[model samples]
Target: MSESLTIVGIAGSLRAQSYNRQLLAAAGELLPNDVRFILADISNVPLYNEDLESALPEAVVTLKQTVESADGVIFATPEYNGSIPGVLKNVIDWLTRPRGQSSLNGKPAGIIGGTTGMFGAVNAQMHLRHILPLLNMYVIPQPLVLISQIQNKLDAAGHLTDETSQKFLQQHLDRLVSVARRMKNEQ
Candidate 1:
C-alpha cells in the first residue's frame, strides 16, 4: 500500500489482434490510477528447452525478472483445443526454472479470458487455477470473468467498449490488486 502497485499482464496468444491480447491491453484503463498494469511481451521466447535453462535466453531472463518484480500477474489466456495455449505454458515453464526457486512462487495471480465460443475460456482458466498453485502462486478464486463472444464486445480498434464488461473487468483487477496489496503488506 505504501508503494505504487505494479500488476503485469501476459496474453497467452501471440496474434496481434487476439481477444486475449486485446483484453490485456485494455486492462490498464479499468485499474485504479495508482495501480500500474504492464503488458508482458512473450513473442521472443523460444520453445521450452531444458537444455537452454543453464544459461537462460535473454528474453527468458527479461520475462523472469519482470514477473518477479511485479506484485501480481494476470494471465489472459485463449483456450486451444480445450486447454491453455502452448506459448503460455512455455512461458510458465521458463518461470518455474532452474531449481526450487521460481519467480511465480508465492505471488498473486488472476486468470481471465475472452473467446468467440459460448463457454469462453473457462477450461483454460480452470487449467491455470490448478497449475499455478503447484508453482506456489496464489490464484484469485472469485468474480470470474469469462467473456464469451468477444468479437461483439471489442471495437474495431481492439479496445473493450462494452460498459458492463468494463465494469466487471474493473472489479476483477481491483480484487487482484487487493490480494496483491495484502500479500505485500504481510511480507
Candidate 2:
C-alpha cells in the first residue's frame, strides 16, 4: 500500500441532516486513526448521459479519481420505497461508464445503511449489493451494518448513541479495512 491505507465513504443521501450521512461519519470515526478516510462528495455530479460521455463533468472526473485511488469504498445508502435511492444509483451510473474505464472496477467495497423504516434499508442494501458487481466492485460479505429505525439510535449531534448499532458498525468497518489492507498489499 502506498505508505497509507485509504478508504472512501459515500453517503447515498443529498440531505444535509441525512441519517445515512451520519452513519458514514460514524464509520469514519470508528476506523483506525492511521487509516486515511475520505467522505466522498457526490453533491455536484450531474446525471449520467451517453451524450455527455465524451466530455465528462468535472465532478464526475473528480469522483472517479477519488474512488480509483482508494483501496476500498463504503457506501451508506438510504432506502427509498423498497429500493436504493436514485441519487446513489445515479452516482454509481456516473462511475461505471465509458466502457471498461470504471473507477470502481475490482475495488473492495462494503455497504452500510440506515432508515426510518423497520427494514433498516435492508432491501435497498440488497439491491446495492447486487449492483456493485456491475461496477466491478467486490462487496465485503461479512459483518453487514444495517440500521433500522435509525432515529432512535442517533443523538441530536448525529453520532450513534446506541451500543448495538455502534458495535455492528465498528465490526463492519474493521472487516472492511482488513480486506482493504489485504487488497492494498497485493497491489
The top-ranked prediction according to lDDT is 1
lDDT of each: 0.89, 0.89
For model 2, the superposed segments whose C-alpha errors exceed 4 Å read 1-3
Instruction: Supply the global lDDT for candidate 1.
Output: 0.89
Write the residue-wise lDDT of candidate 1 on 115-168 in tens digits: 899887999999999999999999888778888889899998889988877887
TM-score of 1: 0.96
Runs with alpha carbons beyond 4 Å of true place in candidate 1: none
Give the clashing pairs for model 1: none
Each candidate's number of clashing pairs is 0, 0
Query: Per-prediction TM-score, please?
Result: 0.96, 0.96
